[model samples]
Target: MKRLIVLLQVFLIGACLNKELTNDQELQKPIIQSPWVENPDEIGHDFYPRPQMKRANWENLNGFWDYAILPKGEKLPTLFDGQIRVPFAVESDLSGVLRKVGENQELWYRRSLSLNSLQDGKRFLLHFGGVDWESEVFVNGKSIGVHRGGYDPFSFDITPFIISDEDQELCIRVWDPSDQGPQPRGKQVNIPNSIWYTPVTGIWQTVWLEEVPEFYISSLKNTPDFDKKTIEVLAIISSESVADKVVVKALDEGMLVAETAVTPGEKAELKIQNPKQWSPKDPFLYDIEISLMQGDQELDKVYSYAALRKISQEVDENGIQRMMLNGEFLFQYGPLDQGWWPDGLYTAPNEEAMLFDILKTKEMGFNMIRKHVKVEPAQWYYHCDRLGMLVWQDMPNGDHGNVWEHRLGIVGKATDKQRSQESEQIYLNEWKAIIDANYNFPSIVVWVPFNEAWGQFNTKEVTEWTIDYDKTRLVNSASGGNFIMDGSKITGHMIDLHSYPEAVMPDPNIFGKDNILVLGEFGGLGLPIAGHTWQNEDNWGYQSFTDKEDLANRYKQLIDKLEELIQKGLSAAVYTQTTDVEIEVNGLMTYDRKVIKLDRDWLRSLHQKLYDLEIQINQ
Candidate 1:
């Protein structure tokens, strides 16, 4: 791990903390058998990981793996020092390796497993839920896979590398420089402070294996048409011969809606009448069962679902552009979700923990969450769908060059067009992968290309391409800063003009001209709980408050000001954050998912009023 140049006193303190980490050491002591804390009997974690696409046979390799940190350009470590859990980033407490693999270091992981259990005429596939920047994997020291991008899932067919009856060794290597590299890394820095946190390196997400047929469905893409009340389905197969005879079976409420077989590359359409629309209030999801067969012989099968919905911007009665969901204007009240956990960092400690954040937000009266910069696990979106939450997904930023803009407050200007182009291509590729991965989920309605000019460039092209890639969702060209007035909404950052417990509604007339008015950011309420912060003393937010009551009082006042703006033209707003992350102590919940800083009832009241305004505007 890369060492930080800290004061001698602070370095000694960190060394003491490292020595005091006993529970994690105990957790890592078991070698042959991992000391996994599988709280299956616990609430929330038992739900299936993926809701949109369901498969019956799969195993989660999330417990423990041998890990070691090496110096720059060092060969793979010869011996493992200890163990760390898969899926959880090194910076997270749950990983059992609470250290930073900064720009100058490398992380290595190795594990051995028997594949004999997967020998029932089933093919073996290796899957990575997500990795920070770059990763390379080898099975039995034979290179099998390489993947890039920090937020998209990728897989490799390891059938050739594995002898089904033998114990195969899996090895992985990763490198991430966080903010130092000109990559789409968001808010990660070696020197953590303020908005930035410690860099996450190596396998930060789930590393698992699945058993499937030789020729199986690789992915499913769904497009919904609210006007016709129909959905279009396109299933991609691994091979071409099986593609020509692809058959789709659509199911709703456990009943078959329609059955049709089409050529692999063509759109297979299914129609429904007066479909139950999906929203924060009524998140109705129709089930779908699909099977591909050739002459009565089942080749492959999978289960998925979709919802009929539309999101757009339209002129309201007062001649101001308003965000319309399902053809009616609605005021969107949500939180700025950073998607981090104290224990799991990038991965949640348990699945329920993931759902808890969304459900708690909804209970607090929010209908949406601006998934800031980071893309979450598929299960995260599934929870949002079932619990009734809206999402604005941001493409993870990379390729350097946005640091100056952030400091100078000159957002949305491209410094070097060359780097911007490279970053844009990478962004598009990952965005398409994310869109394709979650295309079936109905909760996500908007795509945010850039945030506050963090690696932002070519907004018009990126926004246009997003619309072309997925016509069903709205695209906010940029959020929290800058305006080219090209996309669907005119978003503004309204907070901390003087104090942290602050809020502002941008002049509706700016977006009332053509774009819908939206407060992309607001309400950075901060309260650092004792024993619940990454760094106790130096913890900071936009503004700091001493007590919960004071924070709540100021929050209510901010909401009241926002309410007045909604009466004028504001259509949507996002609170500062869903949970506190690293040194930024400005979240409704603490970093460890322990407590809610504000009274639940008080938070819910604010949301109830926001939703009520939405209904009124639509009427």
Candidate 2:
């Protein structure tokens, strides 16, 4: 992978610990797999990776693959080092190769392909759910394509390189600088310490193959108009000629609600009468089907889904700006979910384990989740979409050279980090790809381009550009720093402030005049369990507690303060986290999700009060 001069922030909160980690300490780590992980030695994730738009004629190639760690300039391995599990990072325990491949080395993976289902007059597409940083693909030793940006999915057409009749071979080479280079690596470091965790290199998501016709549907972009009761779909087609059209259908429980036909490049608007609006209380998704057609023949058909939900803002009767969900004010409260796993650093052990966090968050009376500075797999968003959970997606933070020094409950204006032209373009490209990849998911209500001003530059331009690109959702330009509340330079849809250990917000009289006021992060009440932690000793939180009762009481106090702030026009709030990660022990649950540090019922009761304000949002 290419390298850039991205330096570290001079100051990182929390004193440095674990500076002298040894191989013995790594050996002593217990196997802390999730409860939903079926097998520890053998990983299993057979579910379809891409759920937003799916086709039946696909094969999951996620079992075992030969892997080798070689020098950065070394050629593709002729002699494999060993077998590493596909989709799991090489450093993960489940991969059977808990070894770090640093910037000096590159990770190579190759596996035999099965073409038993190969069909005549069909095209084959090789797909990788995600490969960290950068990756190059090869089919039968013929170079196919190279893909950058690990957080987004990519694929290549292998029909040209496929040796159809005989056996096939698929190979990939991945190089990730992790924290050593300038990339959007969130909470990852070459050496794990404090809040930063171990580096994740190589394929961290699923890999598969798909079969399609020559003129197949490449992608679908859906936009819903709740006011007009209509859903518009643009089915992009990959074809040799431009004589094809597409038919779009919106269905309710297998029955048709609306249907329309338009050219493949044009948007097909389907109008629905009396549409059922989706909300946190009742998330109703309409099934959709798009078919590529000639004059009288249907060539390809794909299935997808969408929701008729609206995200907006309005001035309240008290002359304060409030975030509106479905034309009503609804409190958005949830944990700052860092999508990490004890066993799987970047990838989940399986689909069930991935869904477990979202399920428990809902059960604990959370309506929204601020996915902290990291993007999750599409399946995670799909779960939230189906389960009626709101999401505020973040562009994973990296290239940290700016000043983000907000002490506990302190506030100030920070300087923007100056970035190289390459670094800036990298950020822009990945940000757009991340949005395009997950645009169809109804769960995502807001998009955060920067958090705590990490690598934040040209904020006004970035925010305005994002707003112009996708008007369907709100954008938080900077989540936690450089407050622009005087209405002079209000950049994005919201103005956020960072508070710690206690609930606090900007003055609604000032901030709420131009922007939606929110507590971007607060209430890091921590109670680390005895045996469930990444490290045995020196585990920490913003405010550490020893007992469950004390933590619960402290949390209640914070929630009480939050309720008062909500009354004063705090539009939304995000707690510190959902679970403890690595050595930072500020979570309601332990790292492995085995123990709940606080009473779930009490949390639910406390959270319900925030939602059950005077302005009730209808289901």
Candidate 3:
């Protein structure tokens, strides 16, 4: 405890943390919030932000918070400008303060905490789901700590700051440079233009508080061994402090399937009689309860869930490499899901609205989603895990200098940028944090480090390092970006290419011999409906259609081509996008999500063929 307090005092940090055209200036166009936001407090974001490891005794600190914008290096302000909604960025309409905090400015937030009937002998922790760029925290005017990453969650033990159960003031100071710096601000820019979006500043995710005993389970790392019919869990204790032992129990519908116990840092293995493997067709999940115990006394208990699945690569009889999920060749097809909201920017107005996109994707008969170049809140991935969506999670790319804008597929130039030491370190730190944060999710099958050469550096080294770091998931070094070929083989696991308007695959004869061939991005068929679009003017897609019928017909033609590519060893393909973002109208659905441009039955029927298309090989 003394060491923890000492380290918290000197917390000075300097760490940090993609598509399409058209820009709408000063979007003053009578933007209506999603019906989901109509009763923002009624139903939203109350779900456990970290679903994998959930405790019963935790406070949800996601309501109105007093905020002020101050100059950089300025002292804490005694008076705030106004109230801004917590867990929403100030630049977002949902935040109630549509403003931008640039590099020269700092965003300050304050809220009072009145702790009553506090649990005895328990430590209090204040957690922020996520804050943009850099953030500093203060409790009752005493500086606690600071964090720099914009996407990953962080917390501080505020038990020491709680003044005898009185009203305690909690404040946070945040500064984000957005695209102005080398941080990983994916698709965010100060000046909005073709493919860049309005800046998101300050806290954009839920803020909460949790209490625990002195020695409790902080995190659980669960790994399911599909072949061995067992699950291994390692419970990490708070502050690396030791508990006597931790017990892991696996249950199926409240029936205990297996149970085991081991020391806190040691792996506890539970052998199952018969494991029901998780797949897109049947995403069976086993309920997990992790408990920390000292002798006969249980100190902490956290509820979690895990799925038994395996991802591997196999060479077909035709000598084409394929992605094997659970030892089966399942051709993956989904959209380039850019998880953005017109009103919420990087966030959705509510939880149901957030799940709507994923639910619609499943309804549209898609089995996978390439989460394009941006990290979402944990709940978003939790939905995918439960709904059985295979995910290709991209590490949000940034520090752009060698951005391959025009050099597209087949005849495109593959370029690698030389980043400064600080920039490279920033990328590495944030990339690791993102992976570690989302590592436990069973839905994510692939980790994409770079997309389309945006801030791509040391491809071979980074790709190899990611592979070494997490051997469970496949690494796409530079998705649809530079295919840095080492002799004949590319640096990444998949040979990915980007082509607009039509689906295309890498030549199986050339690169498919070793790498899994995939169409990383294609099909930007746009049919913007009036009143549902972000802006009435300048809304564009790669190919614009006047009517839904024409769009469907064109999409059918693309699917026909994809069927041919599937036979030519294409293992997976990602459509241009799930919905229109800002003025770029290339989406299956409009930006507002009120109108789904494609007919559900028609699109699903057309998509089912791609999934059923068997790779015919000369026997």
Candidate 4:
């Protein structure tokens, strides 16, 4: 306890001390925020964040927070400038304060929240859905914890630091060096331009506090066994003393569906009669009410949900390897979601804005989206499941690799081969961390090992390593370029031909081996809406258009081109992106997410056609 107090003190002070920032030149233009929409408190995220495991009483720490950005080498500000909604980056307009916290500065956030109904004797835990790069947390000036990874969720038990009062001051100091730092900072850079976007520093995810009982449920691991028609459930109980027995019950609308008894560290399989399968088209969720009992006495209880689905790779009728969703081949098509907003660099303006992207993608007749090189808040995946959208998740890339080594690929020029090895190890660790963090989402059907060879090294080993790590999902060994065919042929090496704008199917007769043909990325059509662009001079797209109508027509033509490719053997194709990022004006919508560049009806018509085409090929 004495050591813990000293450590907390050091952590609290450290958050204030760290200042690896850069010289800040004022941003050319400022971002804008959207008006707040009234939402229900009860069903706020009424849906479960984690499809695999969930809790009922868990509190969501999203709402407004007081923020201040002090220059590097400066002391903490005496007073905060204004309030900014958390889970959103400082540069994001939705955060209420659009400002830049360069590589050499520390961004500070302080919020005083009062807990209302934290039942007596319950242990309170503070949870941060995610924080960029490095973060240190403090409750009432007493340090609670510190975390390194920016994408994964971390929680600290604040029961010890609690002052026995309802009101508590939560302060967090964040430092993110974007691309300049060795951390897994994805495509973010200080100088925003084509392909790279504005830096997202500090808390870019939900920051909430939850009250749990002493010896409460920590994590729920749900694995679906398709062959056996069983769902393996493991409930990890957080306890001071060893748990003797635990009980789990699955229910739908108060009716008993399944129940099981188990010992700590043991998995319990719950079986049902003719379970309703879960898919993008039909996302059936089973409500679960888990109760941890000590000999018929309920000590702790929480509610959650899960879907029964499976993803795999298999040979199709045409003798081509295809992605199988629940034992059926389905051609996945959707936007390349970078998960950035004009207002919220890492966070969305609201939950509605998050849903709008996925819903619009589905509405436009695309069944899947490739979330490019960045992990999103759990709610993003939850929205995908609810709205019937397939997801291909990309592990965030870290460390600079050889640019010369990737000259032949779409990843642009990287750093160098020899230097990339050191980056390779860092990439592997961060990828593993990302995988472990997001492995629970049912929407994520495929894992992209390397994107166009950005910081890519030991391609064959990395591909095989990813496969070995999690064989449950399909693996895109390498998206485009560096066609050293290895790992699973799901991502048909960009061999047959390179540099094609439209969807290109893989050649099945390639050396007598079948591969899943997918256009990992293509169609970077640029349409910079007059006032919606990040920069006027540097803004550029793959194929620039003069007006919205021309942009829409060109987009439709590219997608129409997909219809022909779908017939040949294209399993999946990802449009360049969903919304404009920085100067890259290829998003289906404007950077603010206010303008749908394409006609809604026309997009939906295209979606129907694509879905019908995909189902027919499988049949």
The numbered model that scores best in lDDT is 3
Residues 138-208, candidate 2, lDDT per residue (tens digit)? 88887788988979888899988877567798889988887767788888787777878877888888888
Q: Least lDDT summed over 10 consecutive residues: which range in candidate 4?
A: 35-44
**Candidate 1: tens digits of C-alpha lDDT, residues 76-179:** 66798789777678776667777776666778889986766555546877888788888888888887777878888889888888865679998888878777
Counting clashing residue pairs in each candidate, in order, gives 8, 0, 1, 20
State in Å the error of residue 223, model 4: 1.1
Cα misplacement distance, residue 456 of candidate 2 (Å):
1.2
Question: Candidate 2: misplaced stretches above 4 Å?
Answer: 1-31, 38-42, 116-120, 240-243, 405-413, 484-487, 616-619
Badly placed stretches (over 4 Å) of model 3 are 1-32, 40-43, 117-120, 240-242, 403-415, 616-619
In the range 74-110, model 3's lDDT, one tens digit per residue, is 9988999999887888888877787767777899999
Model 3 / residue 606 / CA error / Å: 1.0
User: CA shift at 559, candidate 4, in angstroms?
Assistant: 3.4
Every candidate's CA RMSD: 5.9, 4.6, 8.5, 8.6
Per-model TM-score, in order, reads 0.87, 0.93, 0.93, 0.85
